[model samples]
Every structure is written in structure tokens, then in C-alpha cells.
Target: MHVCLFDIDGTLLNTGGAGALAMERAVGELTDGSDRPLDIPYAGRTDRAIVADIFRHYELDFGDAALRNFLGRYVEHLDEMLGQSPGLVLPGVERLLAHLHQREDVILGLLTGNFIEGARLKLRHYHLDAYFDFALGGFGDTHADRDEVARVAFNTLKAHRHPEQIDLRRLWVIGDTPADVKCGRAIGAKVVAVATGVYSSDQLAEHAPDYLAEDFEAVDELLELWPAIG
Candidate 1:
């Protein structure tokens, strides 16, 4: 079987600025100062890393208990903000996912930097969660490194589907960042990089992903990367 792992944030849908706003609000509630900047890069970074960065910036404790508290607040705010400013799903994502779902040989899963609940919330809001097999992918809580997440995904695939040896050649990681391309390479998997995120097509092409596209609008072009189904 061919396994495809997809990233959530910019690859499938844009969550407006809900994620950032949520984080800012969460930190503001937890911190003493209202003027402290909570700015941090989100692209290709895990929620765990983002939270850690926040704690580091503000010189707060990054212990498990503190993280839990902060994340709880962040999630709560995220849920609320998402309800108000739920972003747009990119071009051709829904149709492509539906088409891939019908392919017997293709196993669809998510490889995102979002916490499991956060990932679910975003996908559920957009009505796209049904396209993925939640039991067979990696989440941000696992590790800060995208490559580590890919390893976790491979392990999920092995435990759930392949009892014996699995070929890495059949694995594909699809996302819209250079980090996505790098992580895909880290696992010896082919990457299908999109230009739907902050990065342009030219920028993503510089990373030399196995497949590069402006978006998921062309189902046929994407299907070219997959093996023929029975």
C-alpha cells in the first residue's frame, strides 16, 4: 500500500490568525504583563516548540504542569477563535481528498505540528477530518522535530497495517514548507510540496521535493505520484 501523510495548517486549510490570537490570549492570561510580546514563528514548528518558545521568551517555567495549564488555555481560546474566524480551506483540497479516499491502495493520514486535539478541532471545523485515518499519524505532542514525527508515523503504519517489513519508497509526505520537504527526506520518503503556505513555489522548489505544485487543484498531477490502484 502507498501511504500518504499530510500536514494540517497551511497545506489543507488556513486557520486565519486564530492560532496566533489564541496563543497570545493564552499567554496574556497566564503572564503578569500585558505588554509582553508573545510573537513566535509557527510555520513547520510543533505546538510543543511554540509553547516552549513562549515560556522561554517570558522566562516562565516550562515544566509539564505549567505547559499543561498554558496549553489548556490555548486550546480553549483556539476553539472559541476558530468558531469566529475559521479560515478557508485551500483550493482543490476537498475534492482531492475525496478522490484519494476512493483509491484502494492509498492510505491517508496526517503528519502535523498540531496537538492531537488541536488537529482534530481544525479538521472537524472544516469538515475534513473524515479524510484522514487518525490512528495512523503523528502529532505535535510527540516531538518538536518534524523528522521525529515522521518516524512516529512510520511506527503507526507498521503497528496498524504492516506486520512485517515495509518499504519506505511507498511513503509520501505532503505539505507546503521547506521544513516539510526536509522532514520527508529525513525519513527517506518522497515529498509533495505545495506553495499554498507562506512559501512560494520557487522557494519550495529550492528544497527539491519529489513533487512540487502550486496547490492541490490538479488531482491528476498529484495522482501521478501514487501507484496504480486495483
Candidate 2:
């Protein structure tokens, strides 16, 4: 089977500033109004790493309990923020997903930096969650490094499916950042980088992804990458 692992934020959908706003509030709550700043870089970073950075920045406890508390609060705030300001599924995303979903040979999954719950929130809001197989991919809570997240996804796929059913050569990691390219390369998987996120096509092209597009609006080329099933 062909495996396609996708990223959430900036890739499948743009959450407006809802994610940033939720993170700011979560950090503020965790830090007890100690002037927690939202200046930390978030793109392509795992939620665990982001929260850890917030803890270090505020000189707060980074223990398991504290981290759990922070994540719980973050999820709660994320729900509220998403409800208040729902995000948008990027152009051609639904079309691409529908096209791929119609192919029985393709297995769709997620490879994102957002916590699994947060990712679900975004997807559910856009009604895109049903398109993915969560059992086959990785989440932000699984690893702090994006490359390691790729590993986690492969491992998950292996654990759930027979070894022969999965071919690394047939794997594709699709996202909108250089980190996604790095992650795909880590597993020797093909990368399809879209410029729907903060990075432009040129910026992503510098990373040498297998394919780079301005957006998914024209996915004919991308569709051609996959072979037709008999």
C-alpha cells in the first residue's frame, strides 16, 4: 500500500491565529501571569517542545505533572479558541484528499506538530478528521523532534500492519515546511512541500523536496506521482 503522511497546521488548514492565541493563553495560565511571551518559534516544532520552551522561558517547573497540566489547559483553551474562531481548510485540500481517498491502494495518515487532540480539533472543525487514519501516524506528544515523529509514524504503521504491506519506497510525507522535508528525508520518503504555510515555494525548494508546489490547487502533477491501481 502507498502511505501518505500529512501535517496539520499550515499544511491541511490555516487556523488563522487561533493556535497562537490559545498557546499564549495557555502559557499565561501556566506561568501565572508572569508576562509569558509568545515570541517562541512554533512552526514545525512539536507541542511538547513548545510547552517545554515556555517552561524554560518562564523558569517554571518542567516536571511531568506540570507538563500534563499545561497540555490539559492548552487543549481546553484550544477548544475555546477554535470554537470562537474556526480555521479554514486550505484550497484544494478537500479535493486532493477526496481524490486520494478514492484510491484503495493509498493509506492516508497524519504527521503533525500539534498534539493529537489539538490536531483533531482543527480537523474536526474543518471536517477533515475523517479522512485520516490516526492509527498509522505520529503526533506532537509522541516526539519533540520532527524526524523522530517520522520514525514514530513508521513504527506505528509497522505495529499495526504486516511488514510486507508497507514499503518505505512508497511513502510520502506531505507538509509545508523545511522540517517536513527533513523528516521525510530521515525516513528516505518522498516529500511534497506546499507553500500554504509560512514558507514559500522557493524556501521549501531550497530543502530539495521531491515536489514543491505553490499550493494544492493544481494537484494533477501530484496525482501523477502515484501509480494507478489495476
Candidate 3:
């Protein structure tokens, strides 16, 4: 089978800042709206890393119990923020996913920085959750690094396809960030970087992904290039 791992956020869909906004609100609740200063970068970083930084910034405890509480609050606010903001699936994503979903040779899954539940929340809100096999996906909850998350996801895909040797040549990682490119290389998966997120095409090209597109509009090209996907 051709294993296809996808990133959420700026890759699958844009939450219109709902994710960041909810996170800000949740952290505010945790800190009681304390004086904000540090600007922790979010792009391509795992949720654990992000939260760890948040805790450090506000001098909050960075333990498991504390992290869990913060994430719980973050999730609750995420649901609320999703509704309050206008989120959208990127161009041609629906058609590409629909095409891949119908193919028996392809297995669709997520490899994202969002917590698995958080990933589901975003996907479910957009009605795209049903298309993915969550068991085959890796979550940010496991590690602070995206490459580590990619390794976990790689193993999950392997276990799910037990006895079937996965062809690394046929593996794929699709996302919109340089981190995605780096992580894809971690597992030796062919990377497809799209310019659907904050980064422009030129910026993404610097990462030199195997495939780069302005958006997911080139389904035909994907099929032609990745014949195993056929």
C-alpha cells in the first residue's frame, strides 16, 4: 500500500487563526492574563514544544499534569474558536482527498503537530475527519520535535500494515512548511510542499521538497508523478 501522511493546520486547512487565538485565550486563562512578552514561534513546531515554551515564558510548571491541564483548556477553547472564526479547506484538497480515499492502494493518514484530539477537532469541524485513519497518524503530544513525531507515525503505519513491507519509495508526506520537508526526510518519505500556508512558494522552495505546488490543484500531476498512487 502507498502510505500518505498529511499535516493539518496550514496544510489541510486554515483555521483562520482560531487555533492561535484559542491558544492565546487558554494560556491567558492559565496565567490570569499576566503581562505577555515572549513571542513563541508556532510554525512547524510540535504542540508540546509550543506549550513547554509557553510555560517557560510565564514561569508556569512544565510537568505532565500541568501540560495536560493547559491542553485540556486549549482544546475547549479551540472548539469555541473554530465556530467563532471562518476556517476553510485549501483549494482542491477536497477533490484530492476524495480521489485518494476511493483508492484501495492508498491509505490516508495524519502526521501533524497538533494534538491528535486537536487535529480531530479541526478536521471534524471541517467535516474531513472521516477521510483519515487516526491510528496511522502521529500526534504532537508524543514529542517536542516534528522529526520524532514523523518517526512515530512511520512506525504506526508499519504496524498497521503488519507483514506488508512498506516501500519507502512509495511513502509520502504532504505539508506546507520547511519543517514538514525536514521531517519527511527523517522517515525517507517523498515530500510534497505546497504554498497554501503562511510561507510563499519561493520560501518553501528553499527547503527543496520532492514536489512543490502552489496548491493541491494538480491532482493529475500527483497521479502521474507518483504512479504507485494509481
Candidate 4:
């Protein structure tokens, strides 16, 4: 079996600045202050981690209730921001997802830094949600570290226990950041670094992913490893 774990923000689709905007609004509301300049780096990081940092930046309470409220408000505004700015899918994403969805041997799951609801909202907005197996994925709702998120995904995959041995060796982590590459290594999976996000092809090359793409345009390397099957 072939398992593909994908990152959301800059991998499958872009939400323009909707995610960041929603976060700003959430933090502002949490602190009862007007939204200030959001200067945090979010690429390749988990939502909880980012929020924890935001809480620290603003000197807000880091309690459970505060986190829940902040995230709850963030989700509400994320829905609104997405409607206002529905970012386009990156190059070749639709075609690639369609082709992969056709293969019964292929299983798709999200390994995104987005919270589960946030990931679903973005995917659904771009009509990409149908292509993923939500049950088998990991979200950033709880885990702050991306590596922890990936480890959780690895555990979920192990639960399948196919009688014929579910070849975990065939697992692939596809993303656009070095963090993605490192997390893939954390679980001993092959990495496919895409330059469709902030990282350029050369920058991603330094990480030495098993495969690299300017976008999803060159998935031939991946296809060679897991061709469509009967």
C-alpha cells in the first residue's frame, strides 16, 4: 500500500492570508485589544505552536480555556476570511490529486500544521477535501511540534495492520519546507519537497528530499515508486 501525508498551507492549497488574518483576529479578541501587526513565521509550523508563541508575544494567559477560546474564535473568522479570499490551488495540484484518488492502492491523509477543522475548511473551500482520508490523518489541534504530529500519523498508520503487511516503508511526506523534510526523517519516510511555497528549488535541495518538485508538475519520481495498481 502507498500512503501520502500532505502539508496543507503551501502544499495542497494556499489560503492566501486568511489563516494569518484569522489568527490576528483571534489574538486581538482574546486580549480585547485591536489587532496588531502579526510578524510571526508560520510556514511549516503547527497551529498550536504558533498560537502558543502568539500568547507569549502578547503576554496572554496560556491556559487551556484561553487556548480553546482563541482557537474557537480563529476557526469562526477563518471561515469568513476564506470566503473573502479563496486562494487558488497551486500548479498541477488538481490533476495530481485526481490521478492519485483513482488508485485504490493509494491512501491519502493530511499531515498539516492546520487544526483538523481549519484543514477541513481550507480543503473544502478549494474542493480538495474529498480527495483525502480524514480518519487517517494528523492535525495541529493538539500537538505543537510538527514532528510530534508526524509521529502521531505514523502511529495511526501502524494501526491498520494489514494481513499482507502494510508496507510502511512506502510512506511519503510531501511538503514545501525543511521542517517537513525533518519530520519525514523523524518517521523514516521518504520526503518530497515542493518549491511551490516560500522555499525555492535550490533552498529545498539543500535538505535533499528523495524527490523535489517546482510544483506538483514533476511527480514522475513519485509515480515510479508507487505506480497505479489493480
List the candidate numbers ranked by TM-score, top first: 3, 2, 1, 4
lDDT of 1 at 226: 82
Clash-forming residue pairs, model 2 = none
Candidate 4 vs. true structure, TM-score: 0.94
Q: Against the true structure, what is each candidate's TM-score?
A: 0.95, 0.96, 0.96, 0.94
Q: Please list the Cα RMSD from the true structure of every candidate, rounded to 1 decimal place.
A: 1.4, 1.2, 1.3, 1.7
Q: Tell me which of candidates 1 and 3 scores higher on TM-score.
A: 3
Query: What are the Cα lDDT values of the candidates?
Result: 0.88, 0.87, 0.89, 0.86
Cα lDDT tens digits, model 3, 1-230, are: 77789999899899999988888888999888975876999988899999899899988889889878988999999999999998899998998899889888888889899988899899999999989988987889969989999999999888888636588888899999999999999999999999999899999999999999999888888766556533
lDDT of 1 by residue, 151-218 (tens): 88878988998645356777899999998998888878899999999999999999999899999989
| Residue 105 lDDT (model 2) | 94
Please list the residue runs of candidate 2 whose C-alpha ends up more than 4 Å from where it truly belongs after superposition.
none
User: Which TM-score value belongs to model 2?
Assistant: 0.96
lDDT at position 187, candidate 2: 82
**Highest lDDT scorer:** 3
- Backbone clashes, candidate 1: 0
Q: For model 4, how does the per-residue alpha-carbon lDDT over 1-230 read when each residue is reduced to its tens digit?
A: 78888998888888889999899888887778756566788999999999999998887778788888887999999999999985889988888888888888898888888989998899999999999878787889889999999998888777754625446577899999999999999988899899888999999999999988888866565578677655
Ranking by lDDT: 3, 1, 2, 4
